[model samples]
Target chain A: MASPKILIIGGGPAGLSAAQDITDAGGEAILVEQEGFLGGTPKRLHYSLLAPDLKPVEEVLDPLIDSVQQSGARCMTGAKVESVNSGRNGFTVTISGGGKKVEEKVDAVVVATGFAHWDPHKKYEYAYGVYPDVIDFKDFEKMLSDGNIVRPSNGQVPRRVAWLLCVGSRDRQVGKFYCCRLGCAVSIKQAMEVRRINPAIDTYVYYMDIRTYGFWEDKLYWKSMEEFGVKYIRGRIGSINRGEDGRLIAMAEDTILQRPSEVPLDMVVLATGMEASEGTRETAAMLGLELEEHGFVKPLESDSMPVSTAVPGVFVCGTATGPKAIPDSITEGSAAAIKALNYVRKRSIKVQARA
Target chain B: MPIHEKNLIEKEDLLEKEKAVVDGVDVSGRWNTFIRERLLSDYHEDFVEEVKSLPGGRTVTNCWQCGTCTSGCCLHTDYGLREFNPRYFIYLAQIGNVDELKKYGDVIWRCISCNKCVERCPKGVKVEEVVHNIDEVLRRRGVTEDTPGSRWDRTYLDNIMATGVLDELGLTLKYVRAEKPEDFTRGFMARMAVKIIRNGNIRTGPIRRRTRGWKKMKKVAEDILERDGYASAK
Candidate 1:
């Protein structure tokens, strides 16, 4: 059977970048996206509040998305793959969507399916289910995009908005270790946005510690204080309860003050951590790929082995491997293409030798 | 160093000398050998082929034995015990050592079910659930042996069983009374004195009295004891 032009799983930054990479390397690649749209989480995120260098998701990913399209990379949106089986010649991919099960034969599979936000409902004490106003960063982003900061219960502009950090990430209880790598910065950015919009409103950021470990972090911190007047308290919110007025009252022992205080907030934004996407495990199995405990796809061993799985010809890129920035995803995507091309060429050489 | 003193197989063989006969058991899935041996001799070839047929199992077979899962294990660090590393456990599970798995009841129970090792493993092994499943199997076999934590666990369960819920005051009283009767007497006096100092009135009411469902709860506890399950020695 003739192998697929090329099959790239995931429609996000990583998948798109890999498609572009493959095209640039004079190979045909297909980009399969689970979601209806392309840009992934970055597109869903409100990046206007982020640093200047980190351009808006639309502006940043536009060129790459365009390049993939222009380069004749077939983009399949809303594709849910069920299984993958590799044979001596190529891989057989079975995808089910839109009342049809489509099977595609591909020479190599690049898993860049990315990661999902860890659900906060598992941490039952957070009252995520009972409380209407308790939400995560993704919810906050959508609310911010709607151009309103109103509580769902009262439909009133939130006077007191508490942004909670490390809701699911960095918690031993939930088994999610190794911080989500972006939640802290994202929380700070979101808090600044809220503060900028309504100076009269009370903005409190409850955090274990400000993990702005990146360069130019000091500038961001200072800007949050001087420009936006964001109040950052060093402590974790222990419990959340509903007030008589249907507002969320967050209780935390303010370590700096050495006193437990209850803050009645109109909204609580739980900055949840990222986890490997659901498809990752199944896809890893299908391709006979290796995964890290985090459920992210394991990367090739060295620079020379960029896209190769433990089993030859199977490859992985982007957040499929681990949590990575967009720039890194694009870089790895290109590197993966080069490696895939090399793998195919080598396999063909072996085939000729056997013949 | 001790594990390295002799070959692993020899060390295991010597350890087998201390193996106690399980009461009222006849047939096991594997024969009268240690877990490693039974796995290799009776089942290795067929099980390997079986797993290779499974996609998930195929990926499992690709493990290069880097020991990353074992090295990153929290259970190993916290308990200072390693009856089964995540890597070894997976290997055994693949080879079907269902009987010998009961030996890891304590270490397996202490898992806290954390996925830390799973997240850090470069090979993406499901370490938490695999250990948990083994623990479930052990639980079914009535092989629950208490570790060092058995004493406090028993006391806690006893307190809960006696009183529908926990009785902090009563629990402390009972635990202290059993462990240190003289100290408990002094503690009682100190508690009264502190309450008086704080101007808090000490109520002589029951610390934890039986509620409406107390009868049902007692019956349940009695049933649990007589269920042919292993209990820690008093």
Candidate 2:
């Protein structure tokens, strides 16, 4: 019998992992990414370090990219899924790239289209775009990678830096009511990194809650405070403005003390959250897949079949299903691949019986 | 309902109808409690800039209210004067909440200028100067009356202007006579005076002495006070 061909949307961690799984299981997999490169946000944003363990991001991502490359999966970069049509037998996915259109028929599809970083500018009070020194987590990651963690206004080393948590998440005003699960851990990790780089640089983290979730992350949160001496202020910043000297001034009520406080920082990092990627929405719409309230593809049963979507042969993993960390995304990707492989195999068996 | 809403509930704004019925409805439970809307239109918008203009207060606008100042405050800790919150008063002064600041006027003058808050301030806010500036602004605005500390300040300055040196005994007696007449009788001040007498730091009889550059020093100090808009410059 011929191997079942599967089309995996999004060339991110989840999509790459799913392709790896399908290809290893004797199935031909075609992976499509919108950007010109693979590795998704972790690569695009230059995330140098991962949370909980402080492992180099390359340690996790390099192997995944190598697997996707070595597995002989047809990897198409700079390609976008223009349309997806479901037929009696399978799916016809039309991908557009570099002024060329390619049509491919696949037995099953894995929609691992990941999430977009929530734009901090949506919450204008943070003065993210207005102030040069007020940056989001992606920009902070880039700064860390590039070793340019200086005030953009004057190119001076920031003596005091503050990380504001939940810039675009857990706030109904910005329409993001879900916690971007990794935001807290990522901020703690980044703050610790900043202290490690320069212990003289004063670091403060303003948060509603340090929602590190699990035990390992909880330890990391404490380590950030106890070991690194990174100050934790229990308050979401009310507003941020540029000081006269070009420093970013963040105003927040220290809820623990029940006092309104303002700190003039050389730089302010807004720990932005994750939202459904535009591609995720477009793919869901084209495939007639059910989207959750937040625009992620709704799984057939979240409690059991998290990888199975409403659309029969189309599955979702990683942030396509919702906001998740890299490890969780990889796990879901493999799970979705197994479900897709089973569906293709079962359908082929039925086709043979009919014949 | 929401946590943010819970934060918006100030103790003063909380209204509880203990036993009440409205239009045949017994709206007397926890649901009946209402938080008054906070409307802040009376803000002195340039208050932060105003405080920043004073000497040693250039970084008043730099405070991020980390409670470092309050935590390191000698008045707040040693004296256990919880109301002597340097962080809270700095916030009030920055926002120009004069009415709210008046509530803290009695304790604002208690800042010992120990410079501990200054040393501990991560943002480099001259907390001691900012506290004094707040007191100065409040006194200038007539929001608060002259506190015992303010009376002591006046006596200290007057002694310096007159003698070009601090007349410790004269200033202390004058300040106590004006502010705490009961203390003038020999409790804390009397015990200190006895110690000074035993240490040979006090003259038993009237002795004639003058500061060599009294006139020049007085003129310079008066000019500075006048330029800084102090009412006692004359």
Candidate 3:
């Protein structure tokens, strides 16, 4: 029997990992990335470090990028899956990119299209777009990567900085009820980075909860407070205004003290939550895959089979399924790849038995 | 203990008689002990707005009652004055529970104005100022009587107004005489004064000439105070 072909949409960490797994399992894999680059949000945002251990992001991503390159998986960057159609034997996926359309037959499909950061502007209380100093996590990561962590309004090293967590998640006003899982850890990591850059720089994290749930991540959260002295204030900010010095002034009731407090900060970093990417929604619709309320492709059963989608030959993984950290996404990527490979192997075995 | 855990049963609110009879039924001891049931029907819905109008009370509406201010407060941490919860007081003031707020009159003055609560408050509630604002509201509503803290505050302000600078020795003497006469020459105050005198920082005669432009400065201060509806020049 011919090598069973599997189409893995999204050339992100999940898609690349899945593709590498499929090729290793002796199944032909086709990885399609909509962007010109292979790496997804992390690469696009220039995330310099990973959380929990503060390892360089390149240490994790570089190997996956290299694996996808050397695994002989047919990789297509700048390609979009315009549509997908089910046939009697398998599935046909049409790709549109480079001013041309190409069609391919794959026995199975894996959707690994990840998420987009929630736009901080939607939460007007933060004065995100209106105030130059108010930036989102992605922008802060980029600024850190570029070594230009200064006030955007005046390019001065900010002495006082604040991180406002739950900018969009767990906010009923914004219609996002789910907690963006990685936000807390990411904020702590970034705050630690701020201290590393300048110990004199005062960093604060204003949060409803410090939800670094796992034991290791919880330790990192403590390290951020005890070692780095990143002050954690338990209150969600209500309003932000510009100070006379062009500093951002945040107003909130210090819930602990039950009194209104205002602090002048050089910059305010909104730890914006993750939302389903446009591609995830589009792909789910085109493939006729079930999507959860938040629009990520729904798994067959979240507990029992997280990587399997409702569709027989289709699988889902990573942030494309829901908000997850990089490690979980990679693990889900491999899980989805195994599911897809099994589907392909079963189909091939059936064909052989019929022959 | 958090402010919520504060003992609401005050001595004045308790009615206990060693021997008593009610409606020809013998009631005595435990049976005669009747503790007042605290009920709050008066909600100052606009109390939060009133406090917000004050200089440091503008952010009272932003408080979600998280208690971060109390946990981060230096006074609460160092002294564990559970009754000195800034957060709970803000809640009471926001809801306009004046009766409940009156109960906190004593420890409310214990705030040292360290601004740790201010620095750590995520909501930027201007905690120190909010505490002041709460006190101001209490003073206006006659919920709190003039305590030594308020007396000392008046003395300090009067000294500053008169001399355009803090007259530490004069203010201390006046404060001691007016507020705590018994402690005027006892304990910490006496020891500190002797140390100062020995250190030669204490001047013997009348205070040096008033700060430069004392008259002009006092006039400006009085004008502002009068405009703000505060008694000008005491």
lDDT of 1 by residue, B31-52 (tens): 2344332122111223333333
Each model's interface RMSD (Å)? Answer: 27.4, 11.0, 14.8
> Each predicted model: what fraction of the native A–B Cα contacts (within 8 Å) does it retain?
0.00, 0.00, 0.00
lDDT tens per residue, model 3, A1-355: 7887999999888998899999998889999998898889999889978988788878889899998889999999999998899998899889988999999998999999999999988888888889889999999999988877898988889888889999899999999999999889888899999999898787878888878988644466767754665666678889998877777778876665444566678899999999999999988999888888876788999899999978999999999988998889899889999999888888889888999
User: Against the native chain B, what TM-score does each candidate's chain B reach?
Assistant: 0.41, 0.79, 0.77
lDDT of each: 0.67, 0.82, 0.82
Interface DockQ per candidate: 0.01, 0.02, 0.02
**Candidate order (TM-score):** 3, 2, 1
Which is better, 1 or 3, measured by TM-score?
3
lDDT of 3 at A143: 91
Compute the DockQ of candidate 1.
Answer: 0.01
Which residue ranges in model 1 land beyond 4 Å of their true spot?
A1-4, A44-54, A300-308, A352-355, B1-234
Candidate 1, A160-196: lDDT as tens digits = 7888899878888998887877777777777777877
**Candidate No. with top TM-score:** 3
How much is A166 displaced in model 1, in angstroms?
0.7
lDDT of 2 by residue, A65-169 (tens): 998899999999999888888898898879899999999998999998999999777787888788888898999998998877788878888888888888778
